[model samples]
Target: MLKYMLMIVFSTFLLCGCSYSEEKISTFEGQIDYVSGKQIKVDCSNTVAANSEESGDQVGVGYICFAAINGQTKLEDNNGNSLSINDFTIEDKIKIFLESPKNIGKSLESRKFTASKVILIKASPAPK
Candidate 1:
């Protein structure tokens, strides 16, 4: 009986520890240095938002709505971190490391990427 009780206690501790670590996943920050048909590049800051967008046509689990500048396109989150690969907006605020985009052909409205993280940086308003 004592052995079984000890096993249960250890298992519980392990499960709890795993959850705590998952919540502490590392986050990066950077400016949107570059963007192209296939990938994008963000300069790094510190804090970042994972999921935030204006709602899209095809919505589902792990799918966050985002609006690309031109072509009025939406992005799907097949990648690990949906927040990491959000659409880029010219006036968007972001903080992330440099990386390439996975899928290509995504429209960039006026050639500007959608904002990745809402928390990373505060996008300035467009000129009047």
Candidate 2:
């Protein structure tokens, strides 16, 4: 029994260690459909799923971006180009890098620059 437990523990540790890769970068490609005040609505590619969403009784994933802090933030692109969050117009295509919520109480509160980093990949006029 003891040997079996030790093997399970060792396997867990090995699985975790192997999951870490230096070259791995978290990125999401999507289109911003709406922005009101600090609230944002986006629709990602059908192939990819949203990490977070408002509410749903569905299987697929979708996300929304809202200001957690009543302050300004800097938006950047995948190439490291930066833009003022205030200047972000609606219906822009973007690549966002988000940090998963660290605490339950801080889920929505984690949307700020202090809590999360947002990178705007590409911005284009809404398709007419």
User: How much lDDT does each candidate structure score?
Assistant: 0.37, 0.48
lDDT tens digits by residue: candidate 2, 4-104: 99999999999986773222224445577675555445554231223323224442444344433124444667677765665455767765554443321
lDDT of 1 by residue, 1-128 (tens): 99999999999999986652112222344445544554545432121122212234432222212223223222322232333334554545454321223221122221234533234355446568
Clashes of each: 23, 0
RMSD of 2: 7.6
> How close is every model to the real structure, measured as TM-score?
0.31, 0.43
Return the lDDT, model 1, position 110. 17
Worst 10 contiguous positions by lDDT, candidate 1: 45-54
Q: What TM-score does model 1 achieve against the real structure?
A: 0.31
Which segments of candidate 1 are over 4 A away from where they belong?
A: 19-29, 35-40, 44-70, 73-128
